[model samples]
Target: MVLVTAPLIGFSGEIIWPIGQILLPVKIGDAEHSTSTWMNFVVVRSPSLYNEIIGRPGVRKIQAVPSTAHRMLKFPVLGGILTLRKQTIAIGSTLIEEGWRALCGLLRRNLDIFALKLEDMTGFSRHIAEHRLNVREGCSLVRQKKRSQAPKRNKAIQEEVEKLVDAGLMKEVHYHS
Candidate 1:
C-alpha cells in the first residue's frame, strides 16, 4: 500500500490536561471485575496536576497522545497511532453529532444548543484543525478511558458502551495505561 496527504477541515477540543487517568483494566484472579493500571505509574497523580493548572483560565483545549516512550515499544496494536500523520486532522464529527443528539435526548434539553445539526460539526471541526485541538501537545491527560462493566454497575455500563460503539460515537481501543 501507499500513503499520501490531504487537506483538513473542522475540529474542537480543550486547552489543557484533564482530571483523570487513562486506566487499563487488569485481571487479577478471574473473580469477575478487573483492577486497573496506569501508564507512567507516576506519584504525581492527574487530579493534583489538574488542580495546579486549573488556575490558568485562558486555556482553550487539551489532548494527549501516546508518549514517545510508549509508542516506541512498537507493539502491533499501536500501529494506528504510530502511523498518525502530523499534518492531517482526524476529527470525529459524527461522534460529536451523535453525542450531542444523545445528550439532548437524555436531558430533553430544548435550548438553543439543540439547534446544532450533526453536519454542522464540520464547521466546529475547522477550529479543532486550525487551532491545534486535534494534536496531542505537551503532556496531557486528554483521553478518557472507559470499560465494559463494573462489579456494581453490571450490564448498564456495558450497554452504554456498546451503544456508543455501535453508533460510531466511540471506539474500543487498546491502550497500555
Candidate 2:
C-alpha cells in the first residue's frame, strides 16, 4: 500500500494521504464449498478514509455462510497433476505483472507523475494540518505550547490543492472559519 501511495502526490508535491502499509488476505468460500476449496485467498485491502481522500475507492464482497450441519457429501480430487486448484499459473505480461511497461510509458508520456515525488515533500496542502511543539526540561519531556500557522495557504498553492480536491484526491477540511 505504501508503495502504491508513493505516487499519489498532487501538483504541490505532497502525499495525497497516508495509507496502510500492508495488504490483507481475503478468504473465499463457505461451509459447503469450504471443504472442497479450503486454500482460496486474494490479496486485498480495505478502502480507508485516506483512500476516500484520494481518488481510488474499493468494495469488498464477503462470502458468509450460516451455521449448518453437513452430511457425508464430500468432493474428491480427480487429478494426479495439472489441477487448477494446485497449479500456479503465471499470466505473462499483463498490466499488473508487467509494471515495467506501464512505468516506461508513464515516464515517457506523463513525466509529471514522476516529477512530483510525494514522499520527498514535507506535507500535503489539502485535508491537512501541522502543529509545532517544543520539548524541554530535565526528565520533564513535556510538550510546550503549540504554534499555529496561518490558516490560509498561498493563493496559487491553494488553487492547486482545490484542483486535487475537485478531482476527489482529497477531502475539504473545514478547520478554519
RMSD of each: 18.9, 18.9
lDDT of 2: 0.32
Q: After superposition, how far is residue 138 of candidate 1 from its true place, in Å?
A: 17
Candidate 1 residue 72 C-alpha distance from true site, Å: 36
lDDT of 1 at 161: 66
Off by over 4 Å in 1: 1-56, 59-110, 114-152
Encode model 1's per-residue lDDT on 66-177: one tens digit a residue. Answer: 2332221111122121121112112133336656666547435433222233332222212221211234556555576865656777875577567545644456555333
Count of clashing pairs, candidate 2: 0
Give the number of the best model, judged by lDDT: 2
Q: How high is each candidate's TM-score?
A: 0.24, 0.19
Q: How far is 1's C-alpha from truth in model 2 (Å)?
A: 22
> lDDT, candidate 2, residue 112?
29
Q: What's the count of clashing pairs in each model shown? A: 12, 0
Error of 2 at 119 (Å): 7.5
lDDT of each: 0.30, 0.32
Q: lDDT tens string, model 2, 23-106?
A: 444322232232122222221243322322211121112222221121111222233211011111111232343465555665
